[model samples]
Target: MKTASRWAIHVVPGLNSFAYGRIAIQGDAAHAMTPYNGSGVNQAIEDAYVLGRMLTHPKTTMETVESALKAYDSVRRERAQGVQELSLQLGRLATFTEDLQLQPGADPIAVTAARLEAAGIWVGEGDLEDDVRKAEENFTKFIAKA
Candidate 1:
């Protein structure tokens, strides 16, 4: 990152099919990448949450599963790629290179971490399942009122 001016890299998903197994890996396990945009886990959580919803739905079918997976692939592929690209960008700008001397003020790692946390990726040590359940309960209450 310090050696160059403009940085970008596309963090690709590693064997995404790991997500569709009987006993599957969740979050970063199935698809891990840099914390460039901070949405990896948040996006993963979104991925897991959505998949859980789909699998539990009574209408789920091979066709439906395939279709949903396609949609998820479409969305997640870009997300992972984008994060990799951004991390590359930060690496270029922040890291110290042989040719250049850095002032040592900006913290790219923390910045990236903060961004990811905001996206609800890691959630500052918070409980993701609890949040999801609360959301469901809130929706149920709203529906009841309506």
Candidate 2:
């Protein structure tokens, strides 16, 4: 008897914004992902890096920590969510039989492989320096206002 494996990716909107009232969640606590593209660990690391930098900066203080967390949240939420969506899309591409069966193509597997390759760009290509700069800029503005 052949059994099918159950694989799923559940996404929650705005999961990276796990800070509130001096409390913040990081790593897997902030966002969860399936091990589709092996991005879960990397994302968690990124989250920790962002949160750690904000909370440990010399300019950050107890009074202004909230602003830093908010800036981290603002920067991380969209990027993390984008990764989640891409992971889901990659899963769909890997198991694209349902849609392909309906409309038989000359090479369904090839098409799926191409789609997967295209989607992998997001997973593999990201500018961490640029992201950090933007987050710092946002945090600076937040601090200035506070």
Candidate 3:
């Protein structure tokens, strides 16, 4: 086996805030993470899609843009933060640590594999359609009361 010379690892903590106003943040601007599970770009794309749907819906208007943005925040913030946290967890599992090395009866390789599989399941399974529908419905209801 070839010996590795050097390895570097970095993990970013999950961010809970991703919304402000019409000036919405997405991508790395919203949640930055190590390139472990490829969640940054995927979440950004999902953000764009959801924002687009919210903005273009017939119920949304200039007067209601703030309401739409609030809807986006309601729908996307928790889910995006979840993905960010999972990415951080995967990053921690990938990097070698003294604790991992010293743990009795622990198989680092197997643990890593299991963590990765769980992350894959989480990142792969999402109901974007349902999220968008809820955003639209909530926004409509929010504005109806205004």
Give TM-scores for every candidate, taking all chains together and pairing residue i with residue i.
0.41, 0.80, 0.78
**Which candidate number has the best lDDT?**
3
Q: Model 1, which residues run further than 4 Å from truth?
A: 1-26, 35-39, 96-146
Worst 10 residues of 2 by lDDT: 97-106
Model 2 quality (TM-score): 0.80
The TM-score between candidate 1 and the true structure equals: 0.41
List model 3 lDDT by residue over 23-116, tens digit each: 6777777766667678788888889999899888887788888788878878888887788777767767777542345368878787778768
Global lDDT of each candidate? 0.49, 0.75, 0.77
Per-residue accuracy of model 1 over 1-146 as CA lDDT, tens digit each: 55877666444555645435233444666556665446566757666774575456454465444444443443444444445455545444445321223347956556654544444442344454654454344434433453
Give residue 25's lDDT in candidate 1 (0 to 100).
46
Sorted on lDDT, best first, the list reads 3, 2, 1
Most accurate candidate by TM-score: 2
lDDT of 2 by residue, 29-71 (tens): 6667656677878888888888887878777888889888888
